[model samples]
Structure formats: structure tokens, C-alpha cells
Target chain A: MSQALLTVIGEDRPGIVAAVTQALFTADCSIGDASMMRLGGYFTIMQVIDYPRDLGSVEMALDPAIKRLNLRVHLDPISSVALTADMPNTRVTVYGADHPGIVAGVTGALAAIGFNVIDLESESSGSAERPLYVMVIQGYAPEGVESVRKAVVPLREREGVEIGVHPIEAAVF
Target chain B: MAVLSILTYPDPRLQRKAEPVSVFDDDLHHFIDDLTETMYAGPGGVGIAAPQVDRPQRIVIVDVRPKLGEDCHGLMVLINPELAAWEGMAVGREGCMSVPDFTGNVIRAERIQVQAQDASGRERSYECEGFEARAIQHEMDHLDGFLFLDRLVSRKIDLFRRKQYQK
Candidate 1:
């Protein structure tokens, strides 16, 4: 029994998930946390799995299923390690015209402030000639939201982007 | 008079729509008391709904004065509440006791007017904004089988794994 990280990438289409999960089921693998989504135009699946079979058998099980759909797959063994102990405490959003350095500037501002980003999702839309960029970032800000708000102000001005920071509120109902 | 046990998410009961409260009596008052006690029983809870305790009634008790101050209506017991009007929109981080261990950004009306009835069955209305409105809206969602998770800005972008729910 071993834990492995599996990644699948292919054109977005229906039945992609059903095919992959079925292969895992047939291979007798226990699926862990999985994120299956369409990024840009490609459908991707990232899953952590525990397999009782050998690596070859697991690969063979997935080979036919993914290949038939013209998808690419990779599997790598992973050992548990604590990457960052800080949980997300604030949400930061960025919106501006698409440019070369929006990401670097925004992340640099955050890094300079000692904010550790936990998750980031970004997209660009609008016409090809006038594309708009928007990014949402969640991070651990031990010092709180005001600091995050302040840290981004300089980048917001420099990059000509609108940035907003909100402290994560955990209100019980 | 008694602290009621709140039902957490995936219990199915939390997903059941609550029935409108039609009768106002001593029993209703007692249940409201239990709901209030239960709300206070949780850490920093400012509002609660009857459905959270498996009561399946359109009742909510809210007290935001502790956080928002004198401008708020303070302790409010809203029964059969309905959204009368709302204006503007803003995104705020939200969490819920029902679905603990996660928080997400949820867009809510910046200001809202709510129509409801008090414990005596008399009609009442409240207009509030900011966190007070957010808290009331969060509790009202329970009556309709909605959790704050249902209102997240975006499933892919808003959710951050782990604790703290600003429901």
C-alpha cells in the first residue's frame, strides 16, 4: 500500500471523470482529496490515492482509460510533509488591465509584507485587444487584514490595479 | 430556559426547509428561549435559526449589538422573516457552524430591509447594513435550506480550507 499523486490532463469533455474514477475503482485504489476542474480549455484531475497494487499495475489500469480519451497522466509517490503551518486568514482580490507584471508585482508586494499565500486563482477576459485581468488570493496574514490592505496599496498604485483585502470572518449561525 | 443541541451539516435535517411559524404562544416563547440560549452557547455567535436545532420552524434570534454597537436593534427575535428589500452588494468572508472547518467569500446585499414578526405575532421590520445585515441574512438562509456555502462568490476562488465562519 502506497500513496501517490495522480495528475490527468486532456481536452475538456464529459465522461472524463467517470472513466478515470472507474479505472481507480477497478485497480482497488482509495481516492483521497481530489480537484477536478477545467483550467483554460483543458480538463485536469489531481488526486491523491492509496493503492494496494504495484506501480506498474496502477499505471496499466490508468493507461488504457486515459489513453483512450487522449489524455496524459502522471503518477508520483508523495511522503507527508508540513509545507506551511499558517492557515488562510485573509482574502485579497486584484483587478486591472492585463499586463506583463501584474502577478509579479502583486505577489511581490505580498511577499514583502511577509504574507504567505495559500491559494491563488487568476483569469483574464474581455476582448483580445483590451483584456482584463482578475485574481483572487487567499493567504495567512498573522498581523490581520489592515496590514494586507496596506501592503497591497503600493502595488495597486504601481500596477494601476484595484485591490481589496478582507479579513476572514468565521461567524457561527 | 434550556440550551438546545445544534445539528451540523450533512445531517439532511439541516437541508430540510423550515415551516413558517403561525402560532405564537408560551411554547413558542420557550423554544425561542432555547434557541437564544443555544446561540449564546456557541463562541461569539450573534444569531441563530430554529432549523439549526432541528426545530424546522421559521424563527431566528439575533443580537449584534455586542459587535456593531448602539446603531443596531440589539436583541431581535424574528419569526417568519422575509426579505423586503436590498440594495448594493459586497463580498465578505463567511462561515457557519453547520459546515465548520471552512470559510469562503460570499457576496451579500450591503443593506437590507427585513420583514418579520416578533414573539407576540406582531409584525415588525428592520433595516440594517454592514455586518448586522450580514448576520441576519445568514440566519435567514437556514429557513430556506441554504448555507452560506451556497452563496459563496465562486466555488473555485472563494473557499479557503479550515476554520472561522462569519455566517
Candidate 2:
């Protein structure tokens, strides 16, 4: 078993990550995977750090750091299910006049079909004269399926927009 | 007739800058045929470039016609196409076969007009907007030895890996 999941969120500034990492280091915690991003005024950090498997030592390992950093920490035992199996790359693209429900409709459709939305990014700009809304979503197509063709027909019709799906580049290591 | 193997990244051949297709001859036609076959042979690809199939020549084949709806039929265009004009801005998360295993944020033009020749040897120019335009520009960059990796602006952070090579 790996360590607990560690998430820290606060204002963005120099040494926030360093301060948190320094605390983890002193406690001898191993980081599994992590990501930090900033939106407008807030900086957020999410990490999966591994600790000894013993449940007894879990709180002992994490409490000191949580107290020292003054950052909120959520600790959950890492399970085998946390490790997602590699799946084939699948892509979803949506385009329409910039409007609401574009994302909800598309993402809702994907969820209905059992598609996992691994990553998504969207941007909309330009005036009403030439408004453009574009989104790219990457996912994994279910195994044993030869195609996702016709899967997005309802999405296209309901959203009144263009929706495209194709298998993403399969990276053979 | 040859169905050349589509080279994934790190093959070294994919990194070469293709020479301009000055020969509008039989060899060029053959190259186009191979590129078409290669594009269709992949899982589901809408475009292919000369460099992708190990031939470093200024040629690209794009067929968004298949992706078009019943109201619109996509065209399988052969472009020696030069981008003539562009406007607006777009940020997208894109991935490529050359840079397999990763996807990144890429910023590109929203609309463009490209002047070029079709598959039939007659000269034609395409005024592309939206997805078609983006794909055209993306594939055209291959002729100059550019991959989508060069356009990446950021990573998903959590998705980042220690060793990210196109192997």
C-alpha cells in the first residue's frame, strides 16, 4: 500500500510548495503524484504521498506536518484502485457559438456513455458577431469496442453544435 | 504502389524537414497515394503529411469530408498549401502521434485561408475555418519539421511524468 493523499490550497506565492514539501520531507513522506495550478488569485496543490502501510502510524506521520504548515490536509489511505490502468486514448471535440450548456451537454453525454473525462480545456472569445466556443476532451474508450462512431450523434443534435470523437494517439512505450 | 509505414516520434525520420515537392511527376503521385493509404490505415485519422510517412517532402493530405455531417460533405484535399490569412485566437489541448503519450495546451489561429493544389494536379486554394483550418495548419507544420510539441504551452501538472520522450 502507498501513502495518503495530500492536498493543500492557499494563496499563490514563492515558497508555498517549498514550505509544504519541506514539512513532508522532515516527516520522511514519499510523494506519489502531484499537481498544482492557479486560477485568478488562488494557488492550489494536490498530491498523493505515500506513507508506511501501518494504520497506527498514519496520523503520527501526518499530524506534525499538518500542524507546522497551517495548510489544510486531507489524508486518505491509498488503495490499489487509485492506480488506473492505462487505456486507449479517446478524444472529444465540441464547437459552437459561445454559450452555456455547451460543456454540460457534451460532458453529460460522455458520462452517460461511460467515458472517463481524463482531461478537458475550453475557451470562448470574440463578440456575438463571431462568437466561438471550442473544447477538447481526452478520455479512454472502453475496451473491445471497434468504434465510437455514432456515439455522439445525440450530443451533436441536443447541443446544436459540432461534436467530434476519435481515438487519441496510442503511445506504445 | 507503396503503403509506407507511418513513423512515430523518435524515429529520426520524422524530425527531418521535408524538401518542397518540385516534382509534380509520377513519383509525387505515388507519394500521395502512399500517404492516403497510411492515413486511412491508422485507427481513424483525418489528415496525413509527407513527413509522417518518412518522406520529407512538402505534401499533405486532409479529408475532413468524412467527418462532415449530412448537410456538409468534407473534401479530401491535397495541399502544397500556404496559409494566406488568419484571424482570432484559440487555445486547445492537442496530442500527436509523433509526440505520443502526452497532450498539452496549444494556441493557434481560429480561421485561415490556404492556397494550394488538389490531388488531381489542378491548382486549388482552400479557405478553411474552425477545426479544418486548425488541422491543416497542424499538418503543414510537419513539412517544416515542426511537431505539436513545439506549440505546447502547459501540462496538466498531475499528468506530468518524469521521463517524457517520444519513444
Which candidate has the highest lDDT of all? 1
lDDT of 1 by residue, B86-128 (tens): 8766677777777877776777777889999999999999998
What would the per-residue lDDT of candidate 2 be over residues B1-167, giving only the tens digit for each residue?
56677788777787788886655777677777777877766544667788887778778877665554442226455556777777755555566656666766565677777777776567776667656777777788888888888776653331222322221
lDDT of residue B157 for candidate 2: 30
Per-residue lDDT for A42-157 in model 1, tens only? 99999999999687888889888777899999999987464557878888888889999999998988888789898888878779999999888888887788888888878877
Clashes of each: 8, 4
Steric clash count of candidate 2: 4
Off by over 4 Å in 1: A82-84, B69-71, B100-105, B149-167
Candidate 1: residue B92 Cα off by (Å) = 3.5
Supply the DockQ value of model 2: 0.06
